[model samples]
Target: MNKKKWMRKGIALALSAVITAGIAVPPATAEANTGRIIGAIIGGAAAADEMNKQIKYYNTTEEGRQALFQELQEKYGVYYRWDLNSQLDRIFTNLTAAIGSMDATVYDRPYNYFINQQEGFNAFCTLGHNMSVNVGLYSYLSNEDEIAVVLAHEMGHGQKDHPAKGMKRSLGPTILANATGTVLGAIAANIWNGQGLTKPMEWEADNLAFEYISRSPYNPGATAAVWQRVIDLSGNNSANAFDIMSGAADHPSNSSRRDNYAKKLTEMSGGKVTVDDGDVYVNKKRLLTPAPAGGMSSAERAYFVMGNLAAAYRNGHAASAAYADGRTVMLGAQPIISCTDGDTSAAEIAALLNQIK
Candidate 1:
């Protein structure tokens, strides 16, 4: 056939021979290499298709279920299985019930969640409804409702079958699909990383999480507040290297996510907030100046400014007049945004926010 097709055929034959002869291929063999050779890696796009089919079949087995957990444990160590388990149990149970109230079939396999001792503020959901929340989550966020939103967002990924879709996007089948001794484990362990998801996927999860918390007892405002808190916690920067939840370069900016919830909250309250370029309109009044471009894009910084206003108003943090504290602007005592060289002064932003009430 063609050069590409001819190489794929030859590699497929080699793989078939390798399988038939029962020669062990270490799980990391292909992963360690860049896959420049046709025969060395899983054929290519055709091979990726085969890998997807294999994962589909493997997902139904008990081995696949346990293997993913095993790989996670091997990589992240066993679950904490301590006080955090009870807390995680409460979170998972509440989220499960909230989600199940809408779509009961989502629980057909039921979610199995636990805590890992990882210090990075992140959590993930993989194939088969298996999930893990990092211990570092508690360090940054103590509000139960806030934590619930994070978990619910991950559950949204599981509900939408994003792990498989994302895996294809991220690694393109590659060697992960053909891996032996629980390929799903290798898939889950390597894929579903914070960066694996697309912007649309992240937004979808954020929207779904807002819907879930809105329907439940948890505060829907946390959807925006969590990011507000993150922005506040990590000032002079838009992304935090340690905060894997919203800090990854590939992940949607926390400001973008926060702004979405902010708009939803406004709609829920019968108010209006619209965005154009990097500028924001609240109740048809344009306020909240965007930071000058240097680190975070003005577009993203504009959203964060709006999200801060939403959280301040919704959670009653805007009762006091906005004021500038040094280079940072404050909504009462809470920090909103900071100023840098060639950027809008923090005092000017405070004046903008002060016009709210």
Candidate 2:
């Protein structure tokens, strides 16, 4: 086997063994040694530090996880009880088994994961091993590899300490707004709006996710394809540009990502593996389509649009990117404002654009 594949399998074996024995490898020592491996993902050390602080506050223990769980339940109408708990345990069990063999610091505590039943595809990772993937994402992923791609992507954020840095930089003030929103519903909008994360942070998550997956047996090529599936599933709408529903946050445009992944796959496979549509693998052994493209109609468009609008309103631009063009203030495309030859009301167009998205 090639060196990368051999090492990847070795790590996978080690990780799987660790998980089988119910062990966790921590990154604290590594963090100290590396002095926080926050490069290019978030903007700077300060931002990475802030994000870590937030993650530490949220995921240090069961109580903290429960507290955040409760808060999420109240806000998103989700329950952290029963079958969901069972599902998490199963996922944890498998993930632990898969990660134990690696030569890395294994922590005692397993990472915390939760799913909000929100309509759009969104997930985020916090420091101290805190991560959440939306139920909307689950509805579409369909397979273990796809799910692995998603989990690894989120895990990349935590492993790289992006959340700790990002939270410190952005979420601190947003927390205050969240408090105000708790009392006055109207305040939530403003609170979520101002606390959006930086673009670079998103890119970091994507690249790290790609890195982590590259080290795994599961195809790293699928990352971009999975993202494309998400885009197609949610319609071609870019309204929720920042929202990770379809879970493509911390990255560039879907079409752009597809192109980039294809190029990278070529390099990784020594020009043997070719990609098409950003979602298929074309190798000598076989041709594989990651997932089927369900027909995207106007109704689906409206569904994802509404989902994006909600995500935009709730998580601000950074969180709503999956469903619509969250990056642009306008709901649809670039040049945000549409001042045609005859029509007027630029401000109205912008406001209406928000509603429509």
Candidate number of the best TM-score: 1
Task: Give the best candidate by lDDT.
Answer: 1
TM-score, every prediction: 0.61, 0.49
**Alpha carbon lDDT at 99, candidate 1:** 86
Q: lDDT tens string, model 2, 160-244?
A: 5554454345434443233221111111211122123445655555665556555554445456556556666654454464355
The global C-alpha lDDT for each of the candidates, from Candidate 1 onward, is 0.62, 0.43
- RMSD to the true structure for each prediction, in A, is 10.6, 20.3
In angstroms, how far off is 270's CA in candidate 1?
A: 2.5
**Per-residue lDDT of 1-357 in model 1, one digit per residue for the tens?**
886676555444433222211112334554233233433544445666655554453344456555655555556654565677777888787887888889786677677677776776777776666788788777877767678888888888889877666655654444544433233333434333443567788788888898777666665656776776676666535455544444234676667777778778677534645556667666677765466453345655665555455555655667788998998888876566677775678888678767854
